[model samples]
Target: MRLSSKHVLVLSIASMAGHGAMAGQAESKGFIEDSHLDFMTRNLYWNHDYHSGHNNAQRTADRDRREWGQTFRLDFSSGFTQGLVGFGVDLSGYTVIKLDGGAGHSGQAGVLVPEGNSTAHEASSAGANLKVRVSETELKYGNNLRPYNPVFAPADARLTPATATGFWVVSNELKGLVAEAAHLTAAKDFNSTNLSDDFFAAYAGVASDTVDFLGASYSVTDQLSVSLYGAEYKDIWRQYYGNANYTYPLSDNQSLNFDANLYRTVDEGSSRAGDIDTTAYSLAAAYTWGAHTFKLTYQKIHGDQPFDYLGMGPGTFHDSIYLANSSQLVDFNGPNEKSWGAFYNLDMAAYGVPGLSFGARYIVGRDVDGSRMDADSPYNFYGSERSEDHWERDLEVKYVVQEGSAKGLSVRVRQATHRIGNGASDASADQVRLIVEYPWSIF
Candidate 1:
């Protein structure tokens, strides 16, 4: 007999209860006493101009993108019941309305509302999670999840956030160390109604039944930290990751920071992804002094196929520290791509403006070798064999209210220009985004 997801969650939770740490702090405020309700409201506007002309098929097929949406998110959590095996629940939901969107008038790219006969007009979803806690350990099962591991993470750049159905446990029983594990069966994109074995498996021409993972993070000292993680997608691929970071103080208000990330991936079981043998890595260095900060980054992809990853849909965004390239609407993850970037940031607080900041960055990618792509792949694989280069420039400004009724109101503006050095791909575009968010607490 096949066990349902709910059954597996129950059994797993029960089995791990005996090993729960009993050193947790008791909630003297009680279960209902410590409950919380919060709301986050977001307003988004997006504009992009495709400059590939008739040289790219996609550019000729779609028009310039311009749209706006208003989104609302609600969160509710009940404190654990006062007992050895404390139980609790978390609830989250979102409601989004398209202020302005139309077919043939815009290109979505999964950043605004998804294009579904006019971006579905509006979309909404609700999710719930059951949780249990003992000492510093927690076990949870639900539709709303955000996994920070290297393999997967939720996409939150759209009007509605992505969700996944899974069972996970996290423990911090040992000081300075954190351990986590999970088994996920399905996922929902930011703009979809149903959950399925999609995201990562679809790229490989097969459906993944489950994804299991184990991970740990350790802080060796006040200035050094490290992490390791491993995961397997049934009938798909196996992936492993490692990361390290260090900070060194130089003088009273200056410091230097270094970060490195690595990933090793291999095809597993059925080899549906087709003999995937790739190793990818990146390094970043930054120096900070008072209100001024500067950073440099280098990344490389080593394989026949592009460095791939899972996303809500169409790869709207990611939380990976390895592939950051100024959010120029492209991740620069092309096969065998080599990229270098420089960043500059200024904090306005030093100039008497406590709630304002600005930043700018530039990234250049070269050595992209996409020659071994399988033309018959179902998913739209932009794997290119011809060597080419691309560059992007990004600028951002942000501010927040410091006091009074609108104290928590925050606003951010971002602009980017991306162009291919010698190609005619629709990936080249100029984009601008404006976002506003406000949070409120309700007891």
Candidate 2:
């Protein structure tokens, strides 16, 4: 007697097709195809020194050890049908092998753990996602690892987020306009495959089963766009976001870009037992000339406590780039904490290599107060007992084959160093990562 959401969607599409035919609507149908097979390997080495000692560190609890691992991922995408409305799907998975690690070393954060025995079974997991398309829209149900915005996901590092089982809808019904909505209830961490409801408690206390979000985007012109979004966790919290981006051609060979974002959040119901009210903002500007691109960003958070939100896991890193590194936690875009970053990127194509690039970035955060730590333990929250200032510098280089048998082969390396002052936590460390990928079209 009950119908699944996918089945409902299919029936709706069929009904729409019938109606369109009766109305003499335009009719066209075709099946398009696309796919990517990738093999990615990652290696990380961390050297960390606790600010308040290991027991008092924000991220580490019992001791400090250098850890490393190798991770592999394969992702694929498919195109949908062509007509008044269409449909499609996506699939992806990952595997992690110890390579070199021990009991005290394994499961530090995003790394996978071997199953019953440390030999091999414990370190591998795989999953897939299914999506349906209707016209310029899509509806996805199943496992998904990609999440947008700085306040919603923890993606400042090379590792990915845990997969989430939910339903997401995106639509582009009108030119230059986009809309999105989602209702997710279960999740699995980056290194996990078995779905769990644990995050819901940390996110909204004990009574909620769904996380709902709605958002829209519009492009005002060729180089200007704006967005507004809202998210609500029943009996938990409600948050809103607004952002704008613009790009101007200063000349034939130079351009200027600007971005601004603002967020406001507050508690919602009986589950909103914590003291939390937050507001944050960020502004950024960039200049591009010839082969060089330079950028600068400034951010601030205003709240009694640091800005806090959902995250992938304990070892996840947070940053200000709302796209790749969503800024989250206490003092995030809050009062008492301020941040700034500088970055530069180069396109080798301008010099001759069409598929090579390099980039460097530096970021600093100051005036972070951790006087009020959360009751769930340090790792579960953002604040510590000490006020601290931190800085991070990163460098990366990447290349992709332009043609031939390995045309889609890609290789990249990244290195980063973080330092903390004022004895804040154990997040300060030096890290290096290596990744190689090859995508083969199987259409």
lDDT of 1 by residue, 108-202 (tens): 54544443335366777788899888877788889877677677666676667777788888877777888777888777777665556255643
Residue-level lDDT tens digits of model 2 in 1-443: 87543454455344433321211112223334334455554554433333342323434652343345566666666555555545556777666655544456433434444321234433555656676665555677776645564334534243434665677666665678776666677656554556653344232234345566767789999999999887766565677889999999999889999999887767666544365576777788999998899999888777655444564333333332353222222223323568888889999999999999999988778776545535652222334544567777888899999999888788787777666665444355555566665556554
Show the lowest summed lDDT stretch of 10 residues, model 2: 19-28
TM-score of 1: 0.89
Global lDDT of model 2: 0.59
Error of 2 at 375 (Å): 8.7
Best by TM-score: 1
TM-score of each: 0.89, 0.77
C-alpha lDDT score of every prediction, in listed order: 0.73, 0.59
| Best-fitting candidate, scored by lDDT | 1
